[model samples]
Target: MFEKLKDLKTYEAGKPIELVVREFGIEPKDIIKLASNENPYGPPPKAIEKVKNLASEMHRYPDDSFFELKEGLSSKFNISASNIIIGAGSDQILEFAVHAISPKKVLMAGITFAMYEIYSKQVGAQILKTESVTHNLEEFYEIYKEQKPEIIFLCVPNNPLGECVDAKEVFDFIEKIDENTLVVVDGAYQEFAAHKDKNKEIKPEDILKYKNVLYTGTFSKAYGLGGMRVGYGIANEYIIENLHKLRPPFNITTLSLAAAIEALKDEEFVKNSIIKNFEEMEKYVSFAKENNLKYIDSYTNFIVLYIKNSTQIAENLLKKGIIVRNMASYGFEALRITIGTPEQNDKLLNTLKGMIS
Candidate 1:
């Protein structure tokens, strides 16, 4: 009987348009996917043009060291290349961080990025999950006193919940965690977070002082490079060197590296994307208010709303060709809606209003 595979919960990715259309007998062209927190503005024009030109390089292998890309990122972030390691995505670096350290213990607040818990189980590591949508430094310290796991995963502007623990709170928690433990701060949405008034940017140089904290960031979200899959980790040289052992040579492709290098130069593109996101968020909030739907304020590109029979609502919305994430599995009875172009957002709002009634 194939020995009952390691008991794993299947990941519920936001329903794809094809799947929804087939399941509901709807037209594919009518679907507007706003479930995933993707950049609606799309990739920077320069990056797209560069990716097209670099297509011929597919015949050759990528530089094993990811030299030019790393140099570009390091210069932009004001960190040395020695302190960085490029990966297929930040999630890959997340796995590498855990693999580099042992004896395989994981700690994180509840309701963080679902992948953190999933990846912990894959490695057969012990997981110490705190039971709170948000982490309080005092409560985290109490938990640390009890288990003191070897590694901690902290997602800023955390997924599902979309809340960020203030920098001072994070610093305090770091001071309280066991000195030997490594804290991995996954800032997958950091570029979106640049405008927040309360949270501070976790710079690469700052890691020198907090040697135990390793920060992972991705180009996937803000740069609209999700398909390219290029990301990086910034940490102390020692930790980075140790993690490199677990990284495969040529893990990131040449095309991705090239696109990332060009994207880094287009700061204006990122700035414009952020401005659009903020504007759309305001409209989303106003729509939610007009409809009387309760939503949490979010710094990221997505807004989460609490609703009754959320799965049914999500399904109904899907039938009308608007795909939003169903949070029923998260035990929250909520749906996370990603901010999109003005017209797309308006369509989603109109569809959702109809579904709710």
Candidate 2:
């Protein structure tokens, strides 16, 4: 009965604070979770208030059109509402793309966002991966010429590893591909990448000009709305129209829509979160250096440190009321730690010091 799902491996998210509480008998208040690349500062103040105000509207369904949220996104990106498609999260958008395209062959990085491979497998498509751990356009081109994959996924400022490819390099690579091949640029960490390096920025407007390119973004990271589950894809009107067909009615909740709409209006909150993220990231970098540990120079809200015994260290940290992502599942002996607030970062660093030493 579950034919297509037989080989599929479920995506394992970062250990949640609640899970740590249940498993280790640690109080939620005492646990500092650096596992998920979530905004440790919490959601935007305005978004929080909006969600509270929207609490009474839970009985009603969200607008299927999602016109208001789309409009806010339209104005922000200078793109028409027709060019966008909202999803439960950017990962949902990835699913929509995979289903809509129904590709025979899919291409992605050797190590990238797991959803790319997971969704492709669901559709029974053959998956092709580049040899390099990070995005390499030349290697991608070589594979593209030989395999002619139907869809390509580029995760900028890629997760787990934290390295980014130049936007121009990405565009150049996309330009060489035929119009029939779809290229999905997963920019879940785009805001952080842009803030860290101007060369890494890939604007929605620019992406829209390419008919085959779909740029996906999420409010879960820099926008501090991880709990809201709001994300979107920007492309030409034709691609958005097709993706809409696969979208379920009211895929997101009323409160989530309200939270995202309010979150979009508070640019200052997003800005400050990004600013603090990098500032706190510097501390992690310094800590890595002090311990003589090698780490990827991250452009996202998290950093990945190459450790000799990451799994043991991560477990030890959990016992001390700190939770970090051990990248063992991704085939790396490293830890992907979300950059947290100053106090939170300090606590994590101190805890890590005792473990590593």
Candidate 3:
């Protein structure tokens, strides 16, 4: 019943606030968690209100079709309902994409998101990862030409490193890839990337014209619904149909769906979140420069610092009731620090300065 399951590796999630409390004997309120890249603010106040109002309805299963959430997504993205598929999170959609494509071979950036590899393995696909922290489009193109893999997962504003690929470059890559190859553009950080753009904005819809591209997004980050696990994917109707075939019925809970629908109506919350993010990001970048420490310029909520003793730096902060991701699993000696509120950011900078200097 469980053949090949032993070879699979467990995902190492960021330590929870409660876990840190247990480990370090710290109060939750005093701890600043810039670890999981969760929205520092949290779900829109209206969404919380909506959840509270719906608390009595938990006995009912979520609407099997997810009509309300899909409708909200359709109005927001200007996509047809047929093209969207809801999942517990983008991670679930990643698994659905692998199953839908049923790939014999898969290709992804070596240092992008970790789940791509884990999900790819579940489907028993031959996985080829790139040899760089940031994906080289030229290298990806060459690899596509040589291996002709059946599926590819590209994380925009790639996790850990926080570097993003331009949409034009991605579309060009899509044009050159074999039509049979399915390309999943993981856009969990797409909102932050859009705010950073100068002359042009790259919408997820821009790539939808390509029959081969499936763009996945999540409300977990900016919408502050990480605990709710609300994420959706946009692709051609046929692609989504195949995913629906494999997707279990009523996968999302009733309350989470309601929260997401309400969150969509609160665009101002997301707008304010973006505004705060960039301002805080500037503080982080300036701190890195002032200290003469190298950090990857980020297009997303978090930035990666190249500290010499990353683990020690993180430990020092942990002692001071701060938690940041020590990114050793992605094979980098770095700490991926999420930009938090002004005070939180300042605390992080001061703590790091004390530890490193």
Candidate 4:
């Protein structure tokens, strides 16, 4: 057994509704869970129906090919279905990328997704992180040239901070990297980020034009399918073919496949969710400004607030049946809040204001 396996820090997920209810004695209905950035509006209505309709199929094995899911994604992204690689979630794709590239050294922004580091260490890769609240392209260029890590993971609208590097900047960076280097853009929050600037939105099609670049996104956030765990990676057919050799057969459930098919059909739901999220995000920014709290301007569904005593605030919010992410795990005290419905947002705003004041 690998010696470091004993010390491996398992990924920590946001607190769920039931967990909070059990711990705080809060009623399920009263608990407002904005910690995970799941769409409160729920999956497209058609997807819910699709899941229920396929419930009886649990006795049957999932379709190993995932034909319909790939078709759905291909239609949405306007790419050949042959180029899509489905995984349990974007997380699984990240793992596959690390193992596939077999990088001696991995490079990433210091404060991007935590899983990149965890997976890198799990495979015993030397990881190099360029320190920044947001990615410093100049710093990244220097490190990329010096280290020449085989895999570089870039998460657009980065998780904790909800900030992003411009598409042009990222593309320009990728162009400079050695062709041997695999550049994986984790766009799990792309839908929300797209709302910030339509003209400057990160397009998988645009990014995948580069042979070395692959884009991974999820149905978890805007599609309200986190529980279903459907995510995909888009690249050239060559990368998809090579990745399939490592992909687990029948990895996604039948219900998730059915639901994702329907979810993609209902583009209106995704559009509405983005619209609502933008409205709520603006409210969060305004409230933070009004309270004089320092916050990272978010292009994604979540916002990061710099709070010295973040854990204390989280404890107070949890007591009120409101849950948030505390950034102590990231070594800086801050709070990352997911945008919820207006009433839920109001509750959080009021509670946070009370505590901060």
TM-score, every prediction: 0.95, 0.98, 0.97, 0.97
Tens digits of lDDT, candidate 4, 39-83: 989899999998898899978888888887788787778888888
**Highest TM-score against the true fold, candidate:** 2
Model 3: runs farther than 4 Å from truth?
1-3, 198-201
- lDDT per residue for candidate 2 within 98-187, as digits (tens), equals 999889999999999998999999889999999898898899999999999999999997987899999999999989999999999999
Clashing pairs in 1: none
Report model 1's TM-score to 2 decimal places.
Answer: 0.95
How much RMSD separates candidate 3 from the native structure?
Answer: 1.4
Rate residue 153 of model 2 by lDDT. Answer: 95
lDDT of 1 by residue, 250-316 (tens): 8988888888888888999988888898898898788778878888878788999888899899878
- Candidate 1: 10-residue stretch with minimal lDDT: 1-10
Candidate 4 residue 39 Cα shift, in angstroms, is 0.6
Quick one: how many clashes does candidate 3 have? Answer: 0
lDDT of candidates 1 onward, in order = 0.81, 0.92, 0.86, 0.87
Which candidate ranks first by lDDT, i.e. highest? 2
Flag regions of model 4 displaced more than 4 Å: none
Runs of candidate 1 with Cα error greater than 4 angstroms are 1-5, 21-29
- Per-residue lDDT over 193-251 for candidate 3, one digit per residue giving the tens place of the 0 to 100 score: 88887322457667677778889999899899999998998998888888888889888
Better of 2 and 3 by lDDT: 2
Clashing pairs in 2: none
Worst 10 residues of 2 by lDDT: 323-332
